[model samples]
Target: MGKGGKACDASTQNRAAWLHGVNDLRIQPYPLPPLGPTDVRVRMKAVGICGSDVHYLKTMSCGDYKVKEPMVIGHECAGIIEEVGSEITSLVPGDRVALEPGQGCWRCDRCKEGSYNLCPDMEFFATPPIHGSLADQIVHPGNLCFKLPDNVSLEEGAMCEPLSVGVYGCRRAKVGAETTVLIIGAGPIGLVTLLAARAFGAPRIVVADVDDHRLSVAKTLGADQVVKVSFNKEDVASEVEEIKKAMRKGIDVTLDCAGFEKTVSTAFGATRNGGKVCLIGMGHCNMNVPLTPAASREVDVLGVFRYKNTWPQCIEFISSGKIDVKPLITHRFGFSQEEVVEAFETSARGGNAIKVMFNL
Candidate 1:
């Protein structure tokens, strides 16, 4: 909408936010990659900083994804299509869309089975060598880019990325009217899971978190009750009981968005026999917890690796007013050198800033 107008010029150079090292991000010009036949070039309009992005900026790695080189940083984004490749017919120039960050190798066994998120050859954005979409322009697969509905703004479209994770988690846990859900953690992901669970018709929802502010936000977003907890090991049992008491029913499904050993253990402890524990957080790679007891009770531990076939439902939830993600976006910044640094810092501080967004 600025320099490129409706379509980016062929010779136009794209400016991207690159993470060179820990706490180091720069706005620099980068050469655009060759667009494949089925790809579409998009001019980014909205980009939200994710927890993984903040982790990488703070520690130079997220889980096993280390920043070996200067990589563009961001995945939750929405943009206007600036150009379409030869074989791309689903989208055209000027289409506002939300991007699905991962593209799997179609030949993989996981892809064939419809769980492409597990594909070993998946080239996901902001994961190591894969460049992200926090730039002036990006070339992405047309199929992975879903056109936003008329009612959804570009910022709302970008929020779909995080919402998809919650939707996918709820779907996997099979939340329904008869189920009593206990969501551990009231961060952005936890709050979205609460909204998703309610949308999926979970009769009772109790959100547990250490922070009262976050818990209040969750309650405002339709959580039936909110319980405050701490990380103390001694508090785990009590917290579990508190969460269950708040729910006022046996926990049918526990979506652990904190992923700490304590949180995961509480999820297991609180869940009813033959219930589910969906671990959606990536707080720790390895955790020591009482898994034997939960498993012996037939309480299943479910893990989420991003999401699959979730954008359409996420968009529908937003467009149909079943979910409201705009309130989650508490902080906004412009796509500038100074603003980018400030925005990341605000997100990293992790107090009032739930979802930090960049208006590119």
Candidate 2:
């Protein structure tokens, strides 16, 4: 245990999966930090493997955040509250909750302005030095934890992380009944965005991807149309026309879940004049595209970085049955040493798996 009091009874084991180096993971005992006055200790029950987690396992780095030291690996998670600090009042022991991985410095201007996701001093779980929630227990802020409704499972609660991204993106793009949406990429993020757009009353949605299986998944998840595109740059213009033809209408909003330059270009070219293109995927650190053409057409390209206050809306969407995320979870593993390795591999391979989960 770390700080004021011991983490639960010292007798119980607190095992966690840690990433030591590239492609190396070890399950070992972890120390629970002493709870602060506003903290609550959570006993993790479910964790979902994210694409960024796989990136760290494969390269020991995710964008600018690198694993300079051994760190626990997970961010999408839900758990039962085991204990609450002296000043904690919103949660109690036995309360099932979804953990929001990012905690902002409330003192920052961005945080005060309700854009805490953009706070420069944010500490997100499983990023660099911050340990994640894929463990026996974790000490977290009560404010960052949200209580799940009676119908919501721990696994569904964990799904909220990805769903929050989709919800936030849709909100940012102002999708509505009059808008026709074009979603680029049929991966997990894209699929969630499709669900969110539909829930937000998008009249028509067309999804494009390089994989047939993923496109099929998008179709099953309420996408009005799915287009399988080629990897050839020379074929992009024709593909965009095909996509627009499939929609049978101009795209009022485009959500690029695949951050490749090719997808961004397709989005810019396919959207109607004065439409909005929101970029959610982080596939490329730097991308070069036709900015002048998009500008001339009045098409706006927006960038997304994680999410802000979206947990309650995500839970409501799940509980109300507006969006079902359970289908996205294709593989599940236990928290054993070998199982952890397999989970990471399945997520990294990314063939049929949309979301790989850990059943703790």
Best candidate (score: lDDT): 2
What is candidate 1's lDDT per residue for 175-288, written digit by digit as tens? 988989999999999998998998899988999899999988998999989999998978988887777788887899999998998898899999999999999997877889
The stretch of ten residues in a row with the least summed lDDT in candidate 1 is 1-10
Model 1 / residue 125 / CA error / Å: 0.6
lDDT score of residue 56 within candidate 2: 89
C-alpha lDDT of all candidate models, in order: 0.90, 0.91
For candidate 1, what is the total of clashing residue pairs? 0
Question: Which runs of model 1 end up more than 4 angstroms from their true locations?
Answer: 1-12
**Ten-residue region with minimum lDDT total, candidate 2:** 1-10
Residue 346 in model 1: lDDT: 98
Model 2 misplaced stretches (Cα beyond 4 Å): 1-12
What TM-score should be assigned to candidate 2? Answer: 0.97
